[model samples]
Target: MSPNVNRLRVIALYKELHRLGRDYPDRSYDFNGRMRRMFEKNRHLTDPEDIEKAIQFGEYIKSETLALYSLKKYRALKRMYPSDDKH
Candidate 1:
């Protein structure tokens, strides 16, 4: 699977966890750490397939379609250039 897919999964997990009121900082940190490890392990792969993954993970699940579209656009940009690329 692509890095983006993995990231999307992690993001979804975090979101779900937050929505369910699971441990906030801990869950987010754990997911982020896992994502980092995966990136480091897959250093040979391309940057990441962020766009497709973000879309698949419902990055634009807002109540309004406009908000969803805006989220999609924003996520598209994010997928192209994620902020947490320390790996």
Candidate 2:
């Protein structure tokens, strides 16, 4: 892909992560600020390979975050409807 395409892709990923981070289980964590700093830290990455690798890592983070959200929801549901196991 062209450099412009990669740039747009990165921006989109950043925005998605920013939005997802709004409900990041830990309210004290500055997710948006941290994310901004991370992206700024990589502002010098001109190599396509490096950019691709970083993008892949960002995708991984998104997946992990979703997993955490799912787990939180599951825990809430379990609390609301406890199982009747007498073990």
The lDDT leader among the candidates is 2
Q: Give candidate 2's TM-score.
A: 0.92
Error of 1 at 13 (Å): 0.6
TM-score winner among the candidates?
Answer: 2
Q: What is the lDDT of residue 86 in candidate 2?
A: 92
lDDT of 2 by residue, 1-87 (tens): 899999999999999999989989887888778878888988899999999998998899889998999999999999998699998
Q: What is the per-residue lDDT of model 1 for residues 6-81, given as tens digits with 9 covering 90 to 100?
A: 6666566455533533322344556445544544554453445654554344433322333544676788898898
lDDT of 2 at 81: 89
TM-score of each: 0.26, 0.92
Q: Clashes in candidate 1: how many?
A: 0
Error of 2 at 86 (Å): 5.0
lDDT of 1: 0.50
